[model samples]
Target: MGYLTCKFVRPDKQLFEGKCASMTLVTYSGELGVLPGHASEICALGDGVVRIKRLDEDGGDERDVVVSGGYAEICNDVVVIIADHARAADDIDAETVRRTHDKAQAKRDALPEGDHQRAYYENKMAWCDLLLEKAGAQTASE
Candidate 1:
């Protein structure tokens, strides 16, 4: 089977760079699956989990990354994902994510209905939830 060179980067650092058989991620338009030789294009990513299936390995060899927001570009069998925030499932701290979610929820509730800050806090809370979900899934699969 053919493989695609994949790189996942964040503002602080690169999270992953390797060859993958397939990748599935969430975009503004919804979920997208990429494989070797996929058409070149760019996509606006959404807050969700990015699943990468490594090449030359069993089907269980997959990595899940939680991405808050960003963009993905694909060209010539190479995929680069630049995200606002990204972390591997195994690297995340569930307690920290839960605390963040709680704090963001509290702040969102304190803001007025029409306050723009409310949206920011809401988004943060949702991102935390995604992280927690990813972490849980990884734990259960282990």
Candidate 2:
């Protein structure tokens, strides 16, 4: 295995650069793991947690980020994540997360019966859930 360069970008073009031995991304279809030498591919990432195992320079470095939604691409020796919204674990605000979750729940309740609305709420709920989880809020919605 070799070091994999990871770059996560937000819609505003903010970038978070790091290195990881491996990474796992959650998509609407399923989860995909990337390792060194993996085949080139693109993934439509849904709202969920994007876990990255950063290479520790001293002894150990730990970090995690919650992506609202995005697309991920793996090619050559780099993993590129283009996220519609993203926030680091430490950067998430509790009040805002709660409000967002509440809004998603409201939309879910108002949504009509169909796979499209169901999937939409599901994804929104997923984003709020991940945000609350990463933010250390205890009463996050499932």
Candidate 3:
């Protein structure tokens, strides 16, 4: 019935900015959905998908964005998402991610049990999996 002014951004660039009918974003606690008149709040972001429903009068217009880490603030029907990383599902090129994931997996495996860098590679691999899944290019995880 109303609209929300939404801005989805990362340090490098602004990914999405516009008005939408509704939006769902992942928080450290869980997925939270916001409509035009949502109560103002702030939440820590988590690695997951964001779903946005557009204000098309015809309806059924929607978009999904994969994001990892950051914060979201809502006030007065305006939602601002400052993400550490954000990418539209449609833009992912799964073939490239698959290759890099394999490399990251190899690097992670090479690390000793106590290696701190192992976590970085592990996170990368996990992110690759998420990207593959969100892009609908996922092959069953082995």
Candidate 4:
């Protein structure tokens, strides 16, 4: 199989740039897998993981990135992810995420159901929850 050039980036830094055998991206619609010579397309991204598998022996290790908010593009055997925020799986801080989740939860709980402001808090908590889950843990209470 051929390799696909992949680039996963955030505003702050480029998380990854190289060739990979394949990758699976979690998007608003769901997980989408891309391989070399895949059809060109673009999709809305969401809060989830990106798994990139390297195929060449000389290349570096595969990577799993957690990203939120942005878009992914595939064209001409290249995959590009321009995320609003992203971090390598190994870099996620579970404790920080738990704390953020607690804060958002508190704000969300203070509001009645269907409150517009509550939606923001709920989304924050959801993102935090996703991060903590990927970090292999959960809220202190759990």
TM-score ranking, best first: 3, 1, 4, 2
Model 3 lDDT vs. the true structure? 0.89
TM-score of 3: 0.86
The weakest ten consecutive residues by lDDT in model 2 span: 133-142
Once model 4 is optimally superposed onto the true structure by TM-score, how far is the C-alpha of residue 136 displaced, in angstroms?
A: 1.8
Pairwise TM-score winner, candidates 1 and 2: 1
lDDT of all the models against the reference? Answer: 0.89, 0.77, 0.89, 0.85
Between candidates 2 and 3, the TM-score winner: 3
- The regions of model 3 sitting more than 4 angstroms off are 57-60, 137-142
Off by over 4 Å in 1: 57-60, 110-113
Give candidate 4's whole-model lDDT.
0.85
Task: Please give, for residues 69-113, the per-residue lDDT of candidate 2 as tens digits.
Answer: 779999996999999878877677878878877887888788777
What TM-score, computed on C-alpha atoms, does each candidate reach? 0.82, 0.70, 0.86, 0.77
Question: What does candidate 4's lDDT look like per residue over 75-128, in tens digits?
Answer: 999998999878788887887889889998998999899889998998788778
The alpha-carbon deviation from the true structure for residue 63 of candidate 3, after best TM-score superposition, in angstroms, is 1.1
Query: Could you give me the TM-score of model 4 versus the true structure?
Result: 0.77
Per-residue C-alpha lDDT of model 1 across residues 1-142, encoded as one tens digit per residue: 6889998999999999988999998898789999988999999999788899987665548888888889999999999999998888889999999999999999899988999889899888878888888888878988
Candidate 3: residue 72 Cα off by (Å): 0.7
Q: Which of the two, 2 or 4, has more lDDT?
A: 4
TM-score leader: 3
Among residues 3 or more apart in sequence or in different chains, the pairs in candidate 1 whose N, CA or C atoms overlap within 3 Å are none
